[model samples]
Target: MYQLKTKETENSVIEFIENVEQPKKREDAYRLLDIFSETTGYPAKMWGPSIIGFGSYHYKYATGHEGDAPLVGFSPRKAKISLYFATGDTAREALLEQLGKHTAGKGCVYINKVADINEDILKELIQQSVQFLKETYPAEE
Candidate 1:
């Protein structure tokens, strides 16, 4: 059994952001917190030590691996801010194309600062990700 390291925790998202070494990154985190919250219509929660996540869905893979994950999240890292969104959403690729300046990984989009990208596109990405996850893994009552 593999345990996910990034499981949601009770840590303070505000404290985490306030502790960011860069004042600008700290400010960007606050901006992202608002964006993700308003876009997803869900309040933020801490995932692991760094991630500020909004909304969540449980997923079980074909291989029997399963876990709950945030619908969308972001981490203000040292080098660049990493944005977390749904990986399998086809719309994500298209949105990434429209997103201004950023680099992406398996499931994280890296941006130097909030000013480096378009907030509207980021909001669209967040909305699409939440919709995709809700459809893919509808929440249980």
Candidate 2:
């Protein structure tokens, strides 16, 4: 019975941003909060102690592990910011190609700062990720 640790919390997103060690990262956190909220049509919520997530969806794996996760989220880490998105989205690779200076992991896009990436491309990635999750999981009404 493995439990997901990143469930949404009622903690303040504003306070989280304000506590960021770097001033620039704090500013970028606010900027991203606006971007993700506007794009996902959902208000920001704290995921665990760090991640600022917008929307959420429940996913059940083939192994029967199930958990709810954010549709799109970002964390301002000490080294770089981590952008979380759906894994195996068919359009993701193409969008990442157009995205400027960012490094990719299985499901996280790491960026040095807000200025290092193109805003339009980031929005597209957010939209695509949200769409893919909605289509794949189809949240219960």
Candidate 3:
């Protein structure tokens, strides 16, 4: 069976953010922590070694590959800040256009800093991602 590398851990999110090498990235991480926490109404959690994630959801693919992942998250990397959002949301593209400055991958949006992007747009992305995931993959109760 294949295993997922990124799993929720009991690590300290504050300690992780404080240890961020760059001063700017560290500050941005804190800001993101506040934004994501307030927006998602979920506490910040250490997902794997680096990602600071909000709410979580479980996803199963047609290939039988499934795992629980954060509905929204971000990582302040050395080069750029990576924002994690739902990959299947079509509305993301439209919002990204209005988002000040950023580069996006399949599931991650890279930004130079928090100031470089629109905070409102970021919040919308977070909310949309969370809603999309919840609707797409409801909790198995």
Candidate 2, residue 73: Cα displacement in angstroms equals 0.4
Cα deviation at 17, candidate 1, in Å, is 0.5
Looking at candidate 1, the ten consecutive residues that score lowest on lDDT are 1-10
Deviating ranges (above 4 Å) for candidate 2:
none
Candidate 3 C-alpha lDDT tens digits along 1-141: 898999999999999999999998899999999999999999999999999998899999999899999999998888999999998778888888998999888889999999999999999999988998999999999
Model 2 worst lDDT window (10 residues): 1-10
The sequence of per-residue lDDT tens digits that candidate 1 reaches over residues 1-141 is: 687998889989898999999999999999999999888889899999889999889999999999989999999999999999999878999999999999999999999999989899999999899899899998788
Model 2 lDDT at residue 18: 94
lDDT of 2 by residue, 21-140 (tens): 999999998899989998889999999999999888999889999999999999999999999988897799999998999999998999999999999999999999999999999978
Quote the lDDT for 55 in model 1. 87
Task: Return the lDDT, model 3, position 112.
Answer: 95
TM-score of each: 0.97, 0.97, 0.98
For model 2, what is the C-alpha lDDT against the true structure? 0.93
